[model samples]
Target: MSQFVCVRLIQGNGLDLTLFQFDYDLTFAAFFLNADRTLYGRYGTRSSLKEAEADMSLAGFRDALAAALKLHAGYPGNREALAGKQAHEPRFKVPEEYPALREFKLKLDYEKKEFNGCIHCHQVRDAERRLLRERNEPLSDRDMFPWPIPDLVGLALDPEKRATVKSIADGSPAARAGFRTGDDLVSLSGQALVSTADVQWVLHNANDGAKLPVRVKRDDREATLMLELPTGWRRAADVSWRPTSWDLRRMATGGLVLENLTDDERHEAGVADDKLALRVKYVGQFGAHAAGRDAGFQKGDIVIEYDGVSKRLTESGLFAHATQVRKLRDRIPITVLRKGERVKLTLPMQ
Candidate 1:
């Protein structure tokens, strides 16, 4: 039972606010009270109520919340009438004795976490895990984050190429293993890696937190890089995230698309040889959407410029921006170059 709260505010008439604007200030505070009315967890923004001013309007913001609550708790037929309309509302009722259930109910009572928020699932899972831990329970190997990180296949060839460097996502165990770009992988233990599948196969059989022998080919020689594997590799497959519409929007739009500019098109557009004759990959899926469709962008479009700035797709931060920023569908605004022309559009995550 996790709780979720969404606070939407309509700024004063003159306030400059857009859907694209990222709000980091508005904090929802949940003050749980015990049977004796004693204060409990003050879950909300990262600060106290007094410290959260200027950036937030607690009262005006809370008014809508109070109204909604009053409707649900006091107004006649409000709950029944709105039940089908509120898709995100919690569906289950909780009993009083369960502490986790109680905490979850308390949070929801204040609208801290959403009924379907990540915190909600985590809270429920946390509660169950806590009960298990209290009873000295143990979880199986498949109940953890997947690990036994592997080097990208073909890493041995042109290992110095930054373009080919393996992606080491943040918080991954490989990050803890000191596995960095340009550190050519030679082998596991004493065996040489012939393909990416080889590394994957080795990891498939490996267990959690197990230290394995690693040999990295660096500067034309082989060197062993000792590292430990993280636990719960099997559990990785079972994990799933309930992406917000914003998350879906970001995923749909962010990714690189490059197409080759034909010789006739290049001449017609007066594009230079330096700008043409090669496929261009840019941030977000440019040619893959309705806005970008049939605009001469395809699997191979040569990009000349982006937003009047001459730069590579990787250099422009479009790819990273698309993947990193989970923006609401309303705020997406960006333009990219395709075949010497600039095309701007909002991306909808598929």
Candidate 2:
């Protein structure tokens, strides 16, 4: 810590998007950069909603810091290798630039002793999606699912080490690429790897069906492997656990946060395993988020059919279908199971 100057930014009220671009969904994110603004790498990763902190540790932080210092020592000689780490030009430069966040000022009003309100990191992602909704632009798989965790490709990383493979799933891209459990990821594509977040950065920028070359250390020897992704790989990701999923609810399910019914519950509800069995877990209140409630949806309602479609679908899949198929202001008919009886309902597409 003594070797570096630390600046902790608590708010994204006036965040300079052109300079500080990373995964906005993260609760905590850090950047390692040179004085001239050359990016070394990023630190921070979350893959679970129940235990988001389980994937990070002080040891991993120390490993990433040491790696950054090593990169810093190499300096200009490694600058070309760091070029891919920089962010691309964004549609909205800053948080406030998004249409949904236009009501906000550049900074927060801090007249109060404890300081006033400010934009939370998750709000930035929410605002981006809301702006697209306002523009009537359907969200692509890339937009809905950003910064895919390594596990989606069948790679589970050891948090205590810098990009060390913990496990590989059978028949996955990582396994097909010859990634072993004990292998240490040295680099992805051409960028040097420092943390799991760095691997995510490379995957984030990758196009469908792209071939990513990886350098790895296995059994005290260096090896090169190629990871080939099929088209629509991002579609395999599940985004229902994301914090921005609330905004997705506002746009897709009329502010209803739905959950898949358990097998027992499905049997009791007379829903077959292959039938729609989403239960309305939470209904949003106020503004656009209140659409479901306004449309006569109850929290305990079991959604057996949505938008005239009735098949087994996760909440995440339903979100994708709703946003892409339905237009703004269009109401879709739905059927729910209430007290062992069927009830008809309408869900507005906001």
Candidate 3:
């Protein structure tokens, strides 16, 4: 640890959005860069709050540091190859500069144990989405779900190791691309890998129907594969796990918390596996959150269909569908099962 200088940034008050781009919801993240601002790679990855540590490990971090030192030694000669790893042109220079967050201060008062004016990492995301929503612009896939984990396309990496494939989901894009267990991911889309977070950075910028070049080391031989992302692949990402979903709930479902029915619950409810059978777990009762309650939605109602779509969708998927397909204040036709009788309702988009 004494070999390199470490700087810890605990607040997002004056964060340079132009340079430090990453998953804002992550509890921990790191970047490796030369003195000249040439970034080597990034570290830190997480899916849900409970599993924040599942995708990262100290041993993996050590390996990444070693890899960064190796890259530093090769510096100018390898600068071009590191080009793809740098952040793209930013929309905003800093968190406070965002249209929705202009009221926040650029710095905090250190003497105060708690700075009420301080901006958090997650607020950066919330502010961006708010700006877009205020402009009545449709949110993109990346906005709805940012920094998708590797498992979305199906590659489970070991936390204690750097980019080592631990398992592959059956019939997934990774498997289709010929990714095998125990293979070490070397690079993706021309950028060298340092940790699982780097892999996500590549995926975050990728668009629909994109084919990404990937290289892996298997049995001491390197092999290349094309990761084919089909249309609507980003819809698989579940945003309910993110803290930002709280705002989404107000904007879409009117603060109604929906939960998917279990296997046994579905069977008893006569709902098929592929059908929509989400139960209304809770309905907010005040201000903007009271829209769900005012719309005639009950806590125990089982949602069978929404907006003429009947296929299964998680709460996050429902938010994505509403955001992409329906505009704000659009009344959606919905059917729910209440007390063994089918009831029709209208959910207003906030």
Cand. 2 Cα-lDDT = 0.87
**lDDT of each residue in 176-288, candidate 3, tens digit only:** 99999999988899888888988899999999899999999999999998999888787799888787888788888898999989999989888889999889999999998
Worst 10 residues of 2 by lDDT: 108-117
Report the C-alpha displacement of residue 101, candidate 3, in angstroms: 1.4
Q: Tell me the tens digit of each residue's lDDT in model 1 across 43-116.
A: 22211234533222444234323333443344344334322222122222322223545532233322554433
Give the lDDT of residue 231 in candidate 2: 88
Error of 2 at 323 (Å): 2.0
Q: Arrange candidates by lDDT, highest first: which order?
A: 3, 2, 1
Residue 202 of model 3, lDDT score = 93
lDDT of 3 at 230: 82
lDDT of each: 0.36, 0.87, 0.88
* CA lDDT, candidate 3, residue 70: 83
Over 57-123, each residue of candidate 2 has an lDDT whose tens digit, in order, gives 9999999999999999999999888989987888778888887778777886566453655777888
TM-score, cand. 3 vs. native: 0.95
* Predicted model with the maximum lDDT: 3
Q: Which candidate is the best by TM-score?
A: 3
TM-score of each: 0.26, 0.94, 0.95
